[model samples]
Structures are given as structure tokens and as C-alpha cells.
Target: MHSLNDLLESFHLYAECERCQRSMQLSVEKLIARLGNDFPVTDLRPRLRCTGCNIRGQDLRIVFVGPPGKRMVFQYRR
Candidate 1:
């Protein structure tokens, strides 16, 4: 498995609020800008917050959206 830093650096993160089900996409640059370069990846959950519902990071579902694999297209439909 990739390390948190590796995942964050190479992929976009999808954060969803558990309470409101609102979601947002975060880039590595934005995360670094918000949390700083020294922030620990394991500690990210406590630092996230839902903009719509004001939910805490601990209550959010965070998914890593990585690059497309072989035989996969760039577009995502769901």
C-alpha cells in the first residue's frame, strides 16, 4: 500500500460529510496549503471539516481518487 504522503501527493481526495452527505474534492496543493508541509498524514482526520454541515473530520468519509489504471478511461461516471 502507498503511504499517506504518496497517496495524497499523487491523487485527489474526496471528502464527504457524514451528517449532510455533502462532498468536496481536495488537491494535494490545497491540503498542503491548509495543513502545512509538516502535518502528519495519520492526523488528517482531525483537521478536516465539512463546509456545509460543519461536521468534524472524524465524521467524514475520505476517499483517495488516484490516476486511472491500465484499460481504464480518464472519465468517471457514477
Candidate 2:
């Protein structure tokens, strides 16, 4: 069986922000706390019921651009 250490060394998981277009340090932190691992994390596509306060419109556009990279627009209208 592959030990955790060996597996970890082989492939690492990382997360990128779908917003600020950067490494989602904040979200990654939270995900790590909940999942227990944060190496091979996925991009964020956070969605929730329409904010009673209507913070955003029906949907939102989540963008991710880290390290002077291009933007990843996530136009979420849900």
C-alpha cells in the first residue's frame, strides 16, 4: 500500500481563487480546516441562496487570475 507520505510526495493539491484571480489563500485555509487536506484542492465556485441583503445580483461572476495571469470569468447567475 502507498503510505500517506509517499502519496503526498508524489502529487500535491492546490487551490486557486475564482475571485481575486489569485491563490485563494483565505478559501484554501477554510477548505483545509474542513477537508483535512489542501494540497490538491479545486477552484472555487461558491454559490448560495440569493443574499437577503442582495449583496450581488441573482448570479455572480467569479474570476481567478493569479500571478499576472489571465482572468477566469465565472459568470454564475443562480
Candidate 3:
């Protein structure tokens, strides 16, 4: 069980909708600032909502994207 603090660096959080298959990047810093650093990563499953399909419960993906300027792939959104 990894906490938000554990993945603050060298990682990115993404929430994907099971129904519509839409994925969006979540801000770890914003989450930590709001939910605190000890917030469990697994606990975000039920809290996530899909903007595309308007459904509850999203599949969380923790991807290692490395530090800034290393490997830029997905764009982070709010």
C-alpha cells in the first residue's frame, strides 16, 4: 500500500474510466496538498470520477515517468 508521499517524485498518477476508456493524469502535489501526504493511493479508486462518461470508480495507474525533462510522455492535468 503506497501513500501519496511515497510517489511524490519520479511517478505520475492516472485515472482511467472503465466504461469510456478515457484516461487523465492527476496531480500528485495537488492531491498531497489537499489530502495530505499520508493519503493512501488505493483509496482514490472510489473517489475518482470520469469526466467523459460521468461514472464513479476509476482504475488508478501509477506510472514511473521519471523526473522532469527526462521522459516527457503524457501531459498532466488538474
Candidate 4:
């Protein structure tokens, strides 16, 4: 399984709030600062919150953005 560090280094982070459906893009550097480098990518849903609705982290859905015209190389389930 790929770790957060690996995902961040390889792809972009797309986070959506379950409440208001608000979305945000996060970069590897930013995520590292917020969640540390060793965190697992699959475990990020419970650690994100919607800035608009102020929803808790558990209600967030996280997706990985791969290169242009390419499907995600890594498989992560929500």
C-alpha cells in the first residue's frame, strides 16, 4: 500500500466535504505540514474538515488526482 508521503509526491489531493460538497485541492507540501509526512493517505478522510460548512473530518471524501488524461495509479477507496 502507498503511504501519504508517496501519494503527495506523485499526485494532487482532492478533498470534498460531505455536508456542503465543498472541495479543495491540497499540495504535498501543505499536507506534509498539516498532517506530517508519515501519515497514511487512506486514513485521511477522518482528518479533514470542510472550511465552508465546518463539517467534521469524518464526513470528508478524499481522492487522488493523477496526471492529465490518466487514471489514478493508486487505488484508494472512500
Cα error of candidate 2 at position 34, Å: 9.2
Give the whole-model CA lDDT for all candidates, comma-separated.
Answer: 0.57, 0.31, 0.85, 0.67
Error of 2 at 31 (Å): 9.6
lDDT of 1: 0.57
lDDT of 4 by residue, 5-77 (tens): 7865347677777677787876768777887888887677777777897776744334555755775655354
- Residue-level lDDT of model 2, residues 1-78, one tens digit each, is 222222232322232433333332234334456545533322223322232342221222323332233333332221
Clashing pairs in 4: none
Candidate 1, residues 1-78, lDDT tens digits: the string is 333456453355566676788877766676677767666655676777888877677343334444446232233211
Candidate 3 TM-score, true structure as reference: 0.81
- The CA lDDT at 52 in model 3 is 93
Please say which candidate is ahead in TM-score: 1 or 4: 4
The ten-residue window of minimal lDDT in model 3 covers: 69-78
Clashing pairs in 3: none
| Candidate 1 vs. true structure, TM-score | 0.58
Give the residue spans of candidate 4 off by over 4 A: 58-77
Which candidate gets the maximum lDDT versus the true structure?
3
My TM-score estimates for the predictions, one after another, are 0.58, 0.23, 0.81, 0.65
Give the local distance difference test score of model 4: 0.67
Give candidate 2's whole-model lDDT.
Answer: 0.31
**Candidate with more favorable, higher lDDT: 1 or 2:** 1
